[model samples]
Target: MTAPSVVVLDYGSGNLRSAVRAVERAGARVTLTDDFDAALAADGLLVPGVGAYESCMRGLRAIKGDRIIGRRLAGGRPVLGICVGMQILFARGVEHGVETDGCDEWPGTVERLQAPVVPHMGWNTVEAAPGSQLFAGVEDERFYFVHSYGVREWELVTNDRTAAPLVTWAEHGGDRFVAAVENGPLWATQFHPEKSGDAGAALLHNWVRTLT
Candidate 1:
């Protein structure tokens, strides 16, 4: 069987190296590139993000990853968006005010945490959706998360109508935020599975297995 080619989109953001290595360790042939052509041709795509959501979206738009992502999704290719990457998949994000400051509304909006602190760091448990392939053989357990802004609502409403599925994995049902979302071939997680130790590896393996 041909090994699945996993394309990791790079846009000069946070520690993507860790993500590259982790995906490789999961038995995928990793290709690190920002080129839209190469990204669109992959068997599966990984959109991992860190730092602020606005900055991440800006870089993504600058490099045209947004278009490539849309094309791939339209073509039915599986995708995994991590961290801030996941936040950008929604309709809008209220993070960092970069999107709001520029007079251009972001697709998703993040809100301030009422928790004791802003950025919710460390490990937190995740409850998978009823039938999530991303959580295959994986129990609902703690994954690494470090962020202040999170997805407020999974289903975005506009013109007095509801939009499509934003993040479809495991929704952070509590007062925290959206943890993950799963929609057919698309899966996104607010937490960094690459930083979740063995469980993270398991998640990566399951993701690759889905592509196969």
Candidate 2:
């Protein structure tokens, strides 16, 4: 089978080089681009974001990244988001008492975690949802994380019992937040798979396999 072609969106945010290297290592033909056409036409679209939610969203808007994502998903194409990339998929993001609108693909808000320690850095285990293809072989493994805010609660409602969204969880400082989500063609992880070492590599490989 041919290697999956993946576009690592370069919308002025994210660890682009690391993400590209990781995806390439996962056996995908990776392209780092800010072009809307490249992003929309890729076999897989990987959105990787770093830093604050507001700034990430700004960068996405500047390149019309959100529209590209929305358009891809509407066509039932695969799109993966990492860190703040995952956070901005929701309806809104609240940081420093200010709320910014998100892509609204999912109904929820990304808020600061109610944890004693801010920025839950380092490796952490995730409670993968049952039968999660994204965590198929990495259910018991830990992934690298670096963030201060997350979706503390899930609010998306699905009437189709056969296609309910799978929500994964992880805990830090006694606060459990949405670690990953698999909803049809949309997959996202709050942790950085590009930095999660071997476990991350396996997860990316699993996702790439789905494309083939």
Model 2 clash pairs are none
35-148 per-residue lDDT for model 2 (tens digits): 999999999999999998999999999999999999999999999999999999999999999999999999999999999999899999999999999999899999999999
TM-score attained by model 2:
0.98
What local distance difference test score does each model get?
A: 0.75, 0.95
lDDT of 1 by residue, 1-212 (tens): 88799999998775689999999999899999998888998889999888876788788888988888888888889888888777777666665454432212234456665566666888878766656667776766678888877766554444535333433333232464677776656778888989999888999998987777
What's model 1's lDDT at 84?
76
| Model 2 stretches with alpha carbons more than 4 Å out | none
Worst 10 residues of 1 by lDDT: 98-107
RMSD of each: 3.9, 0.9
Q: How many collisions between residues are there in candidate 1? A: 15
